[model samples]
Target: MRASHAYFLFVGTLLTAAGYGATFLLTEHFRALGGSEIDTSTTLGGAMAGTLIGVPLVGWYAKKLKAARMGAMGAVSVAAGYGFLALLTTLTPLIALAGFLIGLGWGIFYLAGPMALSERVTDQDRGFWFTRFGAFQMAGIGFSPIVAAALVEHLGLSTRGAFGVIAGATLVAAVLLLTFEALSPQASQARAQTSNWMRALPALLSSRAIYPILMVGLGACVFSGMLTFQSSLVRGTGLEAGTFFAAYAVTVVVARFVLAPMINRADGDRASVVLLALMILGVVTAFGLVYGVPVQIASAILLGLGYGLVYTVIQTQAVNDAPPEHRSAALTWFVIAYFFGIFGFPVLGGWLIVTVGIAGFLAAVLAFAVAEMALALLRGRQTTRKPVSA
Candidate 1:
């Protein structure tokens, strides 16, 4: 890789870490300001919304702004969002505004940074590079709670103080991202052209692409549910809620570091079967957690492995199958499947939890996993009958 590209990767890693840390830290800080559960949920919802909506907008405007400029703006928003929170004593209403701004900033950074990475790396290196990107992200997120725990314990810091730390980290990340050279105007325009929504949608919805999207959407449902309710699920286990996050994070990091490459190399059919089967096992194990801690930890590890591999495989397929011109939109839609899962799964899980207690939630997750596996098998048959050039 070029030195400039390497710089982008380094900075990209930093920016990802900062963005995630801000999410974890700021949520805790927001609670300190008398923010409600509703506020927290909305904030996360807004961030997801921003990412879903912002990718398309960013795709449209890639020609107008350099990645560095976008990175700076994103960082500034993180700072301003957290800064606003610091000023508020109670933030129920204003929390939405904060969510919007923070989400927008986070969304911009999320989309632009990866696009830049994809631009810099060669085709042969794309999977490996993106895996590394995922690793840094996993590390950043995994490390955040530890950092937050330490800051709170050692520094006698308030929740707002932690936000300051998160904000500062993002600001530094933004600066690092800015040091990379800008893509030429022509190159930017070309990428934008490739991502044009008008031309891309129909092609993407073609019969060949539809099955992959379905498979991805199914996997995303499992993932989305976990992100939304894993904390709550851990809390439900009657273990110290505080410790659950630590265990979950550690398990995720282990899965990402150890299994991602192997999963990435698997054929789509083999990967699909394995991924969903693992997810089913994970949820079943998580259900067993209500009975013991060992089960809970096992569930966490299984879910982490299942999710980590499924995401990598689905994402790889999304990019590999799409025409070059539609690559960006393809990714955007691929992520949309993920966001839909994030948005929808929690609500369903919430209802299930109410109806069947903890077991209901696990049952629902297992059901989704099984159904996804079934769909994957059907698609596998189709893929066998009519192979596409990958």
Candidate 2:
């Protein structure tokens, strides 16, 4: 790998840590401020709303801007958002604004980081590189809680103070990104000539990339539903939420790191179908069968093996399937669809968990998993019939 690639991976890890760390603490921070559940949801919703706006807006202008510059801007936005949260003493509308900044920043970074990296590798090595990058990202998310705990427990910092620390770290990421951009002036200018977003939209929506996009979106829903409500899912089962999460995280990192080459070499459509089936099995084992700690751990491992691997597979397809000039647009829409499911599904999941109980939520998750698998099969058959081109 190049020095630029190494730097991008390091900076990407730090950015993911900052974003997810702050998010992990949001609930506790709001509750500490005497905020109600509604206030907490509102704050989170604000972040989601901001992300929905930030992604497409950034994509629309992606060709005109360098990816590194966009990433820098995103880091600064996240810093500003966390900075605002650190200063807050009361649960107010301003909290929502802060959440919005964080979400918007994350949205831009999320899209720009992968978009930028995708350009750095060839189709032959894309899956390998992406899985490695994704492993780093997952490590960041998995370890963020430990980092937060250290800040509060070992360092004697308050929750608000932790937010400040994260903000400072994010700002450092911004500085590093900008410095890298400055040092590589020519590379930044080497991107394809600017193109209109309207012209690229059709390409992303075409048959070549559309199925991967849809499958990813559905896959996101499966991921969010299972992990986001894990606490609820484990209730009364005598299992700590950490048990499932830790097992899942370890499995994901191991799978991505050790299996990247194999995954990259596999048939995309067939692999997706098998992985999606694993996800379905995970949900069934966790929610459908008798509740037990062993069963929960098994479920986590299944999901880790399934979703962890499938994500990079389909994401790579989305880019490779699109025309070279429009690959960025393809990735942008892929990210948008992903976040939409990540943030949007929880609302429905929550409703189902409340109105019809966990069974309803489980049913919904199974439905999505089945649908995604079906889509993967279809995508495979389509690919077999006629190869797509850039």
Candidate 3:
């Protein structure tokens, strides 16, 4: 691999891990401030909703400036948002304001980095590269919770202190991102010249690559519902709500590093089908968690494995067919789809938990997984019929 690719990948991992830490700290910090479970879920959902607002902005900015510049702005926003979070003791509007900045930074980092990485690899290698990227990206997601939890426990720091730590990490990630020469001079000029936002949308919307990508996004919706509310689902199982998130994060880490590599090494279509099936199983395991802790951990592990593979496959397939100039647009649109799922599902999960309880919430999430499984199957068959070169 090229030095720039390695650097971009490292920066992406650091950013992802920091983002994961901030996400955990925010949930715990809000709750510590006497926010209700419903309120906490809503705030998290709303913060994610802010990303929906920011993605189009990043997509637009990518047209005019180098992605590195946007990424730097994103990192600064992440640190400033977390710094603001550290200063506030009350359940103030600052939390919400900070959320918007956090969302914007996340969108820019995600949109810019992957596309830059993809540019360096060939079509036949895109799947492998995306999996490697996801693996590294998820390494951050998997490990940050343990580190953050240790920070909170060992330092006797306030939740805001933890938030500050996350902020510092994000700033370092942003600085690292800014130093890398990931974008080619020619590619940078191409992005700078293509300034019209509307023009990019049509081709993204028209691609044959969209079906499987849609499945990835929708599958993520299922994962979001579980993440936002699984604590509530695991509540009556004699495990503390805090333990649920810890377990969830740990399982996610293991699956990304362990199970995902083996699955990705297999055929992509067959592996995806298996992963979605595992997801359906995970959703079901969640329903069983209402009964006990063993089942809850099982649910976490299953879902983690399922989540680890689904996007890796979808992302691998999404960029495999697109030409280099169009690859950024393709990845941007795929992210738009992923963000839609991330944005929509939590609010719905909160409502479901409030209204139907754990069974109702898992049932609804299961439906999403089942639908995704069906889509993966159909897409697999169709892809086979056409014999895509990649």
Candidate 4:
């Protein structure tokens, strides 16, 4: 790997920490600012809207912007987003603006990081690097809440002060990413013959590509709801949000690091079913949180395994399985659905919290998980595309 690319991986790891560390504070911060439950959740919804806006723009300009420039911009956007959040003292619509920038930055990284990694390495090596990317992301995120707990719990830092730390971390990523050298001639030329990304939408919808989108949507919804309702779900269980997030991040890193090779080598369609099944188990275990902490811990383990593997396998399929020229376009579609889950579902979940109660929420989760599993199985049977083992 090139030195610049290696640095990209290192920076990517910190970038994850930067975005996520700030996030663990947002719900509580917003609530402290007098936000109702629905209002607090809307902050994430705004971020998802930013994602919704950013993905297509990234798709259109991906090759033109090149990876290095995008990385710099993305990192800056992250810092700015957090900076704004840190400065805010009370509830206002401006929280949405800050969330948008955060999502925009992440959205850019989601496209540019993969674009750069895949272009730099050979096809056989893509999966390995992507696996490391996931692991590093988990490590950074895992480490953050601990640090956050120290700053807030022990050091007496205000919530806003905590966000400053997040901003600094992302700025570090920006500086490192800016040092990357320009792409070589071969990469530049291949990127020049760009596909009209919009033209392929109809085809992607009808094909197997849609299945991963649907299945990942399930995972995204589960993740968003878990975080959005952290207080309510674990109210009687005596587990803090930090504990839950720490367990999740640790489990994901361990599972992904140990099992990367097996997952990367598996068929996308079939692998998705297994991943979805694991997610189903995780969701079931998660709903058991009302029962207590042991179930929550078990749920975290299952979720870490399931979510980590699903993204690696399913995303590889989205980008790698596509015709070379169309990879960015394919990723755009996946991202659209990914954010939709983040943006759309939480609002619905928020309503359930206000009205339908725990039973209603559990029922919704069950219905979604079952549907996700069925789609995964059906896709495994129906997909005609030959699987590629990296």
Best by lDDT: 2
Candidate with more favorable, higher TM-score: 2 or 3 = 2
Q: 3 or 4, which is superior by lDDT?
A: 4
Expressed as tens digits, the lDDT of each residue in 349-377 for candidate 3 is 76677787777777888888988888778
lDDT of 4 by residue, 167-258 (tens): 88888887766655342322543452245668887767766677776777876787666655665567656777666777888888888888
Worst 10 residues of 2 by lDDT: 186-195
**What is each predicted model's overall lDDT from 0 to 1?**
0.63, 0.73, 0.66, 0.70
Best by TM-score: 4
The TM-scores of all predictions, comma-separated, are 0.82, 0.84, 0.82, 0.90
Ordered from best to worst TM-score, the candidate numbers read 4, 2, 1, 3
lDDT of 3 at 262: 69
TM-score comparison, 1 vs 2, better candidate: 2
What is the TM-score (0 to 1) of candidate 3? 0.82
Cα lDDT of model 2 by residue, 1-390, tens digit: 476645654565566455654565565566678853345456666777878887876666656677767877888888899899999988789888997898888888787666566556566776556666677777666556556656877899887898888888888888776675565443533463334545678767775788888888888888877776675676666776557667787888899888766766777777777788898899888774345778888998999999988888888789778888887677777887887777667657766776788888899988988988888887777776332221
**Backbone clashes in model 3, listed as residue pairs:** none
Q: Stretches of candidate 3 above 4 Å error?
A: 1-12, 120-129, 182-208, 240-268, 290-293, 320-328, 381-390
Candidate 3 residue-wise lDDT at 174:
73
Candidate 1, residue 183: Cα displacement in angstroms equals 12
- Write one digit per residue (lDDT tens) for candidate 1, span 14-103: 654555554544435655666533456666666566556655666777556755466566767766776666566777667656666676
